[model samples]
Target: MVPRVPSPRRPRLPSGRAADAALAAVVLVLVAVGSLRSLIGERQESWETTALAWALLVAACAALYACRRHPVPTATFVLAATIAYYLVSAYDGPLLVAFVVALYTVAAEGRLRMAILLAALGLLLTGAGTLLGNHDVNGVALFMMTGWLVGVVALGWVRENRLALAREAEQRAASEERLRIARELHDVVGHHISLINVQSAAALRRLRKDPEGGPERAEEALGAIKDASREALRELRTTLGVLRQVDESAPTAPVAGLDRLGDLAAAARRTGLDVRVSTDGERRRLPAEVDLAAYRIVQESLTNVTRHAQATAVTVRTEHGPRHLTVEVTDNGRGPIPLGGGSGSGITGMRERARALGGELTTGPTLNGGFTVRATLPCPAAPLAHLPGPGSAMANGEPPRP
Candidate 1:
């Protein structure tokens, strides 16, 4: 399998040419300052002193520019050169800025162990040279060196934290988007599929009863088509409500569940399919998610029968337990089942529904020369409120919640 590449997170810095220009300006300023300091008191300075000091100063500034790309190597070269200069002529100025920039780069790009090792080595070399070259190692020098190293390390730490936070936020947003898409797909597709399965069976039944009445069968098919179209419209409205704005309201309607299984079986029977439903365990009110998942599993299986399975009989079995709900739809359709043969929207939609409900779906040929779609969904402890109540509310004389 090919590895998935993660999206790049860091924003690109503006204009490399502009950065180079800025670096050049900084280098010129440093060189001019060093030259002015050298001629502070002397009216007539020796050519040797002037040439040697300015050359070393320009070399140090160039090292700073090189450090931008090759930080560790440039830092080492500059530190070594500065140490040699101090040992020979006891010259020192704002050259510490180059070392600080190099340290920051190393800390940002390298491993913690390597960054700390390089920092310790650089500090030790500079401090040792200062003490040995008769340049009094005062408190001010110690504070400045320590402060630079600390600031660079802190910057690296902050960068790492910000990157981590940004990654977490991206993952969270991706997850939310997946969920929203899943919900929209389910509502939009599930209703129409259900209506199609219903209308097809109705037409098939009418044709079986009166083989000569072709017009009647055609009319039934047309009715089924109409129902499917209306269902599609309803789902589209709901989905548009969600897409428009968070405050937009959706139409309230009954979603198919266990209660609608009987109607589904009756419709299939009308289409000449001998579909039987069996319950093996005690049935209780289940969570809306589990109920909907179970209902869709059976509906999709029946729909497949009408479309692919050239068989007469199909069975839907449901088993409810304390912690789980299991549903299986089986049919004696053909000899060999094409479990992974073709890609169809129905199959994909069913799989997505099962996953959204935190359930598992398996479909393949059975040992007895039949196809079966089985699903197991976790049952919540409490019942769903949206489900229809038992019998008529008026018969019980109970007032509905206001």
Candidate 2:
């Protein structure tokens, strides 16, 4: 069974406290004015009765200040005040608006069940008083009030759902970006570091075997190590630059693509591995995401060979079809091939990259005592007919030259 992960705690709305206070103040002023005007219609009532009704109205609207923080409690208080005001006053006023706002706040705070219970209780009491001839409100007014309360509850619930969905979307985007960064770091650092280790070890072995004669071979190994380290630093800086981007400015480093396969192969060859790259179909410019994915897959496959496969030679093949681009890395190594999609083998990450681009990746032992990683990536052919003629100073939506 899949384990349930709890949703993150909901963050407060922007300027939530200030906004809540402002809403309460506005409602209080409106309710006070409307209720005083309503009381003028019943001039025969005593001064004490008028004062009590006004107090209840103020209390109902004032309770809304804490509605967001204590939604259920505030809603209950507001409901009681509204009911008391209607019972004592000769006529109805806009005091019910305070109760409506309170009910909406309760539901918006994710207290749907509590809000519904309070609303039902208020409606029941109002209906009972009307039936007993204690309330001046008629049947039609009670029914209309019921409908308005129901709508307020529904609106609040909808707002809560929308906020929840937006939060989930943001979290998912952040998670995907983190995973992408990890894969880039693994490919960039892992390959070069493995090559450095191999070259350094070889140099040490040579010097131990023959002190004077081994110096020449050791020097060659050291040179390879220097090249590997330099390349690693360059790639590391590029990845870091992308990470440090805080605005919409252009990236400081260029993205790696298939055009750099020659350099990659040469680096692998320096570690005494015979690396060959072959292309079958006509190569064309690919989407940035597809190109990056293809490069990382090949880079990771070779890194696995250098670390696990005790092979002397490896072949990297690329086949560009009309709608898909295929990359295959094969090594004639006697070492064990990872049969499972484990994190250690980086097969999971590679598969994720392929799937992200609506593609698939497969890894298994080759027929002739070898291991191969094959990935097929979906790449739509660029439209050539829509291009501007050669004399145009821009291409692919780029700005024109000065």
Candidate 3:
């Protein structure tokens, strides 16, 4: 036996809280070391003033740990601690790093207005305190600080907007996947289940008519039922397998398309309905999505006829154009077609499938008191050289009467 290959494991990253704590620790060390350099240099400040500055610098850095969770409060605390540290220390340190991080968190948390107000307030308070202390801040120094404050807040705001857009896109993808699964299950299970119901009913009717002779007829119906169930199970397994597939690198099994219309027609014929399938225009390979949509529309139309339409005859037609494929299913059933053009979810699903592929579907009572489902789908195949006109000899594939 071949050796099984293990899947590659994804690298794990630090969680939000752990990352925040790590950031705070790094900031504390950097600020503490940078501020302590003042002691080695010539310093006129007293020992008490130096000790107070170190404590405040550590508090400012530590506040970063709670920045994301309580952004506004953390920003306010860090701002106060940084301001106090600057007032007490003779030399400026990198304590502004923690203040910048806090302001960014505030904006990143979607508190944009508050973050801006806090940023402006920090600049104003720092300038005022520097002036009152008889220490004039140079024009260039104030300009650089203002630039840093504005840049960090703007960056945080951009991050928030990006995160919002990402969430919206993720939600849309999940919703579309749900709809796709619902449509697939309806088409796969609904069609075969309806056929099984009809065959089973026919089998029961045969047995009731003639107990002894009915065995042969009932057996045929039973065989048809078995076939329908097996097909249903097979299609269901394929759909569920796709949903459960963890490895996208593996080859995907092909789904039913227009090529499987023969199988679909065979299943429908078992219900004693004259299901005739005909094609118009050039017949060639179509895009996978288009093929699947066309097949499902036909499958659902046939299913509706089998379950609801009491008519004995139905025609399935596919018209191919250079860039378009039109599918029509008409049944000579006397069943009432909902005035709204859709009786239930099956019709709705068929219309959705067509629309999803930039196509359209129409369902209504045909002029001859029959129900009809028609869909127009865009195909990427080459255009047909000659498309049949309204007065064409074989319009809609129906033979012309001589």
Candidate 4:
């Protein structure tokens, strides 16, 4: 399951028109507050021109406020109003603020062609006052307009990338979990079913041959089948329980791993196959993830033997080294085609289990007339060794986090 991220709530009016209207009112108030000193001062220009300029600035801000929703149109309106204001009066305060905001929105939200067109219009209007009316060339005004416009657009793009990365991480985590669950289900069901099939067929043949003592022997086979089915279903339920609501108060059992290898070998022997397990070096506890993955790989390989190999004898060997643990499974039966010949579920599942723990697996027909599967799993010196005694929080893996 993917974890959710919380976002801050922003204020907005219900309808588009109302939202624009409310924004316009706030912009008007700000303009009035900022221009109060000059509004009641000695009239440098006629009241008619002054009132017209004020109206133009208000119009520019009202349009700028909707730049997020209507980028191209709002930018055009702001450009027209700014040029009109400068043409009518010499006074320039926060009047250019709206124009810059609108330009930024166009760069951030509009298509490339449209953004280029709006940018061209912005430059043309900056020189409009000089061309259409009396005004001096001002480099300061040009710099301020260009800088703010570029800055905010870059800011918006950065925000977009960060959000995308977060979503990608969530998806990767979910996909990995799904793969893991699938592997578990396959190993459990495949192993149980193969044993059941082998035992049931044997019982049927024994009954056909010997009329007496047939019921007693067949009863034993049925009992073994029932046990295998029950165990398989119980494990399936445990694996599926993770998808349900979890309660902290209810303790959960640990996953089966090397500790259950004896049970696995016993089940195989019950199917009349001679199975043997051999280990080397000192054996100790492994990280839960590594342990579970190793167990699944071995389990899948043996299940393949019971189903396809028809081998009378099977051998599993585990070797623990300083840096890695190796597992090998071999059976003396006529080998099937190599795993890569098709989408063989046993080989595919085994490979996935090893790779999930930053390890590798290989499978092929053994020269001695059978199939063999081998895998290697790395072992860290300690679980949290890289972490600074108590405070380090960075998660580690072979490849860096995306």
Best candidate per TM-score, number? Answer: 3
Which residue pairs of candidate 2 clash?
none
> Model 1, range 64-133, lDDT digits (tens) per residue?
6656567678767766655555544434556656556556656665444555666777678777766776
Model 2, residue 350: C-alpha shift (Å): 0.9
Q: Tell me each candidate's TM-score.
A: 0.56, 0.86, 0.87, 0.74
- What are the clashing pairs of model 1? 201-271, 205-270
Model 1 lDDT on a 0 to 1 scale: 0.67
Model 3 lDDT tens row, 82-133: 8888778877788988999999999999999999999999999877876676
Regions more than 4 Å wrong, model 1:
1-125, 128-213, 243-245, 256-272, 278-282, 335-340, 345-359, 382-402
**Top-lDDT candidate index:** 3
Reference-based lDDT, residue 12, model 4: 61
Number of the candidate with higher TM-score, 1 or 2: 2
Q: List candidate 3 stretches off by more than 4 Å.
A: 1-13, 134-136, 246-254, 335-343, 382-402
- The per-model lDDT (C-alpha) reads 0.67, 0.84, 0.85, 0.73
Per-residue CA lDDT of model 2 for 1-402, tens digit only, reads 999999999987546788878888999988878766656664856778888888888888888889999999999999999889988877568888899999998898888999799889989998999888964678998999899989999999999899889999999999999998888898899989999999999999999999999999999999989998988998887788778875545645456777667667777887889887777666667899998899899888888888889899998888878899999999999745556633473778899999999999998888999998999999987634343331122311235767
**What's the true lDDT of residue 160 in model 1?**
57
Of the two candidates 1 and 3, the one with more favorable lDDT, higher being better, is 3
Report the lDDT tens digits of candidate 4 across residue range 1-402.
Answer: 888988888966556767656666676677667766557777778888888888887778877567778888887888788778877876655666666656655665534456556666666667654456444546676666566666666665565566668789999989988887777788878888878898898789779887898878888788878888877887777666656656434335446786567667777887777887777655655788887888888788888888788799988888777778888989999877554654557787888778878899998788889988999998754433232210011111012336
